[model samples]
Target: MYSSVDTIWTLLGAVLVFFMQAGFAMVETGFTRAKNAGNIIMKNLMDFSLGSLVYWILGFGLMFGATNGGFIGTPDFFVTGDYSSSIPSAALFIFQTVFCATAATIVSGAMAERTKFISYCIYSILLSAIIYPISGHWIWGGGWLSDLGFHDFAGSTAVHMVGGVSAFIGAKILGPRIGKYTKDGKVRAIPGHSLTLGALGVFILWFAWFGFNGGSTVSATGDDVLVSMASIFVTTNLAAAAAAVTTMIITWVRYKKPDVSMTLNGALGGLVAITAGCDAVSPVGAVLIGIISGFLLVASIEFIDKVLKVDDPVGAVGVHGVCGAAGTILTGVFAIDGGLLYGGGFSFLGVQILGVIAVIAWVAVTMTIVFSIINSTIGLRVSREEELAGLDIVEHGLESSYADFMPLISSEAATTTSTNDTNDTIPVKRVNSNPNAKMTKIVVITKQSKFERLKEALDKIGITGITVTQVLGCGMQKGNTEYYRGAPLETNLLPKVKVEIVVCKIPVSTVIDTVKKALYTGNIGDGKIFVYDVENVVKIRTGEEGYDALQDEAEAPSFA
Candidate 1:
């Protein structure tokens, strides 16, 4: 029997973790395009469902009962073969289910804006069913690694590290979002749609982590459970505070202003770094862990983006992979009982290192093969045309938003276009075909709600366009109204995005359909769409036109 309070808390924590699906969805969507919002939400939701079922049926036995088998579990699947009742198996399911989801969401951030929901759905099943569980079994199960006296109080190695590696593999296989990398190999800093939402999502995840780390204690018997929960709470907050401050200062010094996204990642990095030792270390130690983790996280994101040429859109690898590994190793050195830093010894560190190495090896090898197979067999990226347009319209055939960018407005005049009423002449940006052109450019103007699906729909067909600008205004209609500050502002023009679909006209209809379907918002504010006919395209390489223009012109939705 268990204490009701413990059970309640555990269940409450599980609920919070479940809500993290929403948090991740918001963060991923905010960081990427609005068109991919539904796709992201779909992926996050399915990830948890698939993760729970798979973890329940397949992962649980391998993780808990197989704790003796040194390599893999021979005991159970469906959690029945060695079913002996000593604990509330349901609680284990709740806690570990969150972990499986966490590992699954890690891939979401890495593969956002481009992955087909179906492909991603299949991968999610594999991740929860096979990838995360097997890696978890190696350390948390009575596997060879656990018997070596490895210590991961939480899941620095088992959950975060494993997820990180999987994320890396998925990202590599998916390639960067269309605009993430340039022809010249320059990394562009693409801003998220909603910084506030992204930041808020991070805070929500931070709050839910109390359940995440605290619920790790499966038994309610030990005072260590309470003590561990308290320690985790204190250290978790401190590390995040330190990380935010560190990242804020670093950004101010380096980039002239504090960046919200980096600060968010820094906070998460701190949490990740301290996760391995939250139970064993003091709050002060947690602060140190966060400070260093913040630095490392920021630095690693840059390194991965530049040196390794990996595109981690949401910094998933840096926050989880690099920091998770760092946290695990630090625990061996900082653990108070016998750490070298506290005059303990190097044995703990060595064990941690071995554990880290084993976890990394397993995840990297497994995910590489899995993703490679998926890519080779089922189609991975959409056709270049579809990519350029957007996945929403292409995959699901529905536009998510109608906000379109007014082509002629200056940056400062962006907000003013709503009031100015003009019906005759729409500000049009034309993109035509050239045999030698290097890229295709198209601007789509429609309702605010429909704008999101156009690009995604286009991308799915066969396009990977570049340099899309999201803006809001109107060309003909006097739309709704808004309250700016205290005064009521009239909403004449609705929102829209200027999709720069850069491709040869080989698959022009793919792009057009996304624009048309999503543009029909069934509202008066549902604005007009203008697809200007391209005139002349120039391919700088060969200075060619017509047939060769398309060969020279480049891809289709996102190019940094």
Candidate 2:
């Protein structure tokens, strides 16, 4: 007899899990450059699409079929074999399918930006169809780990760690993005374009996690089931919150400010850490697990980026692989019944440790083979030209993901200039020359915030025309020393605005005095002014020269 409540709960969980694909898409896109945004979106979409189909064809059987020597499952293609469960077979299959997709999707973030689209697609198929299922059998199915009393309530190891390990291996083999490191081994910070989108994705993932952890119960009718679901929700939330807070404090002290991106990753780390033990651990245990995860997230990211020199755009390996394994092992120390701290000797903890190691070994070796094969044959990464041009343009033919907001210029107009010069000649209008009216050019290099005030001051002093350009430079200061992902960054160039003005009438002293009065802040970065003698000025529209060109048609020349 199937319970409708259990069936509904399982399906609902599957839907929530499915929505995590969007979260992954948003997070990956936001953390990368806008040029690669479309490519990231496509990869996330295809991984889930391909993962779902492949999981149904061969993955389901290999994961849930009859056991074979406690290592693998009997091949039950198309989910044809009868499986005992409280919910319908279809419901259970769909739920597990989404879980399989989650693991496969995690790799895209680690290998983002430079990966070949076809190569990534091939890798996704292999992970979803073979690598994930084989190890999944060992834990979720009646494989050796499950037989030895290994417990992973909601795939901290099976789903998250598997993805994290694959991400590490893939990123390692694929190599770092261009310009990620200097010749002297100094790490360069390639910040994500938008934290707003990353934050939105994090919130979405956090919201859907309720189904991820709670829905694992696969039941809601019985009292024990209801209680377990509530506990899972509470533990899941507490862990994420605790981890976010811990990371904020650590980054605040280390980076001298709360790092938004790292702090967000901390929340994710907490969620991944508590996932394995949400049902078995107490609320207090969840909090402790979250704190540990927070520390591990920051440390792992720093180690991987600086020492190991692996480029992970979104910190997937730290939040998923490291924290996943940590959470699973910690479960043995926190579980109410068999936890070591709860008086259940080291036996259960030993098994937990063994499980994490075995899974890591399994994913590492297999994914290495998969990536190596892909690399040796069709190639795993894009060409230098293609990468520099961005995957969206070369791979997908997309000019830009945010095309509407950009200026509209056709290819022909952008690339080619007409050779015809029929209308190039303009009629010249010579005015009376004033030999004493010397043209002077004034250039102002100042803080960007001071541009408006300086412009107003110039306008009040009868200096109407000026051009401004945003530029980067440094003087005696040589910029500030900052930390990014725990690495010291010596900023040699700072942003500033350059204002240029040419006048044949207004005295240069008058303009200089007005600028100094408006911009004097007595600060280190106040700015500098440069004055130069201009030979002449010309108005292209009217072909007017010298002082006549500098004056607007409606205004009389002050020089006259």
Candidate 3:
């Protein structure tokens, strides 16, 4: 009966863990360009599918089979023979499979936007089959790490650090995204497309982490087991919450505003840091752990980006690699049974450090070989042309995520072109206006967020037509500072929309008033509006000139 109960609990946890793959997909997609959304989603989907297949065939046995010489497992190849005499082998397999995939998927984000689909798929299989499972064997499968009194209760080292190290290696080898750095080595800020989706993904992962840490108990038979699981749940939630708050406060102080994306990553860092000792640490200890993890995440992100020069699109290395190693070491300081804070001595801390170093050494050497081979043979990164054009269209043959919008290149082109272009070949001919037949061109530069309201205001004023283009510039705000790994990246050019409308039938003052009413916010970036005298206007469709050209379908715009 106890065995059945444990099996049920494990299977439930496995399902929750499996759902994190979706969370990863959303987070990666949201933080990247819309042009690469389809490719991001596709890579995420395939990694799990490929990982599960490979783990089932070889990874499961390599991780949980009968141990040999305190190194790697030697038995239960293909999951044959009496591999499960006491528990439900199927439940164990499913639970471990999800974890294996999670580790493999972390690399996808770090090396995103510039990797070949085929190359990514191949590495995903290798990680699931050998890289992740072998190290998992060392810690969780009765191998050397377990034999040395090292405790990772829930895999800060086994899963997260493994993925984190791989992320660093992959990102390093693949190089930074185009335009991430200038010829002078100045780092640039590349903001993600959707903070809402990224935030949603963080929430989902936080919810799923309850199962991830709590279910590691792997049993629900006794009173002590139930109590432990409950405690683990509390610690996990407190740590995540504390880290998020800490990050928000720090970023607000440093950058003069709260950074939503970094705060989301902080929550993940807290979860990773606490995973190692969630079952053993008191709630107070968990809070301390979380606070420190948040600080570490911010600082590490800056250091890795600025010093190491690794371009991890999602900060996977800081959240997982640095935090994971730190969390494992902190477990030794917080664990109730043998923690230094509890009068245990430095023995456990030493063992934890040794275990971390061992795993890092093994993973780094092996991944270096794997990546070097792939980089040399089939190629690890996509060509510069493919990356600049975006992976979705060039690699996957798909349209941009927002199909209604013009191509991304067109918007970029509009930003750099002059607005003074006029075709002089055709003669300037005026039809309706003041006696002089003069015209006006109104150009408004404002926040993209205000575009809908501005357009509505124009509609209310009987203005029928206008053109808007996305652009980047600087003003009184003098741009803003973007924090990566703890480094401050100054962004001088910020995104804004340029709206242009030419009118001959309506007064220019009235058009300016309507726009000002729509976009006024009394802020530094409220934007500016320019009104230029237009000498001529010609309708391309009918060759109509001046006021006739301004009317649509032979209907003149209503004037104020």
**Candidate topping lDDT:** 2
Q: Please, what are the lDDT tens digits per residue for candidate 2 over residues 10-62? A: 99999999888888888888888899999999999999999989998999898
Instruction: Rank all candidate structures by their TM-score, best first, as comma-separated numbers.
Output: 2, 3, 1
Cα deviation at 316, candidate 1, in Å, is 0.6
Task: List clashing residue pairs in candidate 3.
Answer: 301-485, 302-484, 302-485, 302-486, 302-487
Candidate 1 vs candidate 3, lDDT winner: 3
For each candidate, the alpha-carbon lDDT, in order, equals 0.72, 0.91, 0.86
What is the TM-score of candidate 1? 0.71
Sorted by lDDT (best first), the order is 2, 3, 1
Q: Where does model 1 exceed 4 Å of error?
A: 81-86, 219-224, 401-560
TM-score of each: 0.71, 0.89, 0.87
lDDT by residue for model 1 over 232-339, one digit each (tens)?
Answer: 788878988998899878776766667678888888888888878888777778888888887898788878887777777788898899999999898887788767
Model 3, backbone clash pairs (residues 3+ apart or across chains), number: 5
